[model samples]
Target: MTTGRAAQARRAADALRQRIVAGEFANGRLPDEQALGRSLDTSRNVVREALNLLRDENLVTRRRGIGTLVTAHTYRHGLDRLAGLAEELTPYGTVSNEVREARVVPHAPPAITRRLDIPERSEAVYIERLRWLDGGPLSLDSTWLAPDIGHPLLHRDLAGRDLFALIEEVTGAALGSAEVTVHAVTAEPDTARVLDVAYGAALFAIDRLTRLPDGRPVDVESLRVRADRFALRAVLPRS
Candidate 1:
């Protein structure tokens, strides 16, 4: 038989799990135990017990030095469907966008020019942005668009708007398909600054090249996300 205090703690743990799954508390941040206790009208010990329950479930992990951290959860999307960033993060919370830099600049490196099929000296629209969940930076996105089709993109307000939708609107081109690669990389200085992590923190880097209906590559994007903040998951048909 469970005591009333134990039962209360169990209830609190369940509520906290629901809130996390519902995206009330975001990644890389932990909820305050005292505050949670106050909100739940329980004692600190009860809250601690509740947190212990969550820890056992593997939904959260206790670092040796750092406090508890919410482990990355898997997100599933349909194979044939494309969802905007905002839509994809809707389950987490209200996603916000900050346009750090948006300008037309001369191509700098062969990495971008080679993919976009543009000359080294050609100008391309360079867009840098930081995505936030619950007002905290979660990912840094950098993209280069070819000069021929990117000039019109320079004159738009992209805040709170999906880049893919904006591209379709400005160029009248539908996104047919995209090739993407995912890898883990140590965060660089700029990426660390935008993501609010240590200089050498582990990050998930996604490189993607998207094409229009006619197979013309329109954009090349590199996305850097904090390993603790964002996660990618896929489901496959069983053999």
Candidate 2:
């Protein structure tokens, strides 16, 4: 049998989640427990439990005596399919570009070397950009491609272009699959400057390695996005 407090907690949590999705609560605002409890006709204990659920999901945070605040949404992409930056930002009407630093660079990092299967100290094309949404900075992206497959890319106009499409067109390498990982991070000074946010601001960092149909590594992209602007959702297959 379900206890009254547990039921109340579930109801309050669901109600609060709906309110958040509906934009009624507004981001970063802290509503008092008493007010939330009254709104849901429940006790403060139930409200607290509900808020704790949100905090666990990375949707909210509680400070010492500062109440609970809404955190930004983080987007998650499936490992089964490959997507471009533009496609990822479509829902938000976010605009992005290949910054001036998008060029071939030598001596790739160890992580990049391993992902792209390149020799240590090998040259690679480095693409850098600042993504914007409704004219506001959204993310800072840096991608590395093996020189053997990236040299020809330099001849093309990449500004405001999608790197994935460019790779397909140039190499005729159809994207088959990708491995991606997402994590929370604090922005560094350079990343902060490009994203137009303060240093140490919360960020959602994504690291992805894409492969061709034959399983050859094609590109490795590192994406750093503002925690507040992006949200990730997924539908899983039940076995």
Best by TM-score: 2
Query: Per-residue lDDT tens digits of candidate 1, residues 136-224?
Result: 77788898998866777777766787788888897786788888888999988978887888888788788889888888788999988
Clashing pairs in 1: none
TM-score result, candidate 1: 0.67
lDDT (10s digit) by residue, model 2, range 128-158: 7777666777778888998977888777767
Runs of candidate 1 with Cα error greater than 4 angstroms are 1-80
Query: Top model by lDDT, which number?
Result: 2
TM-score of each: 0.67, 0.71
Ten contiguous residues minimizing lDDT sum, candidate 2: 72-81
Position 194, candidate 2: lDDT: 78
Cα lDDT of model 2 overall?
A: 0.77
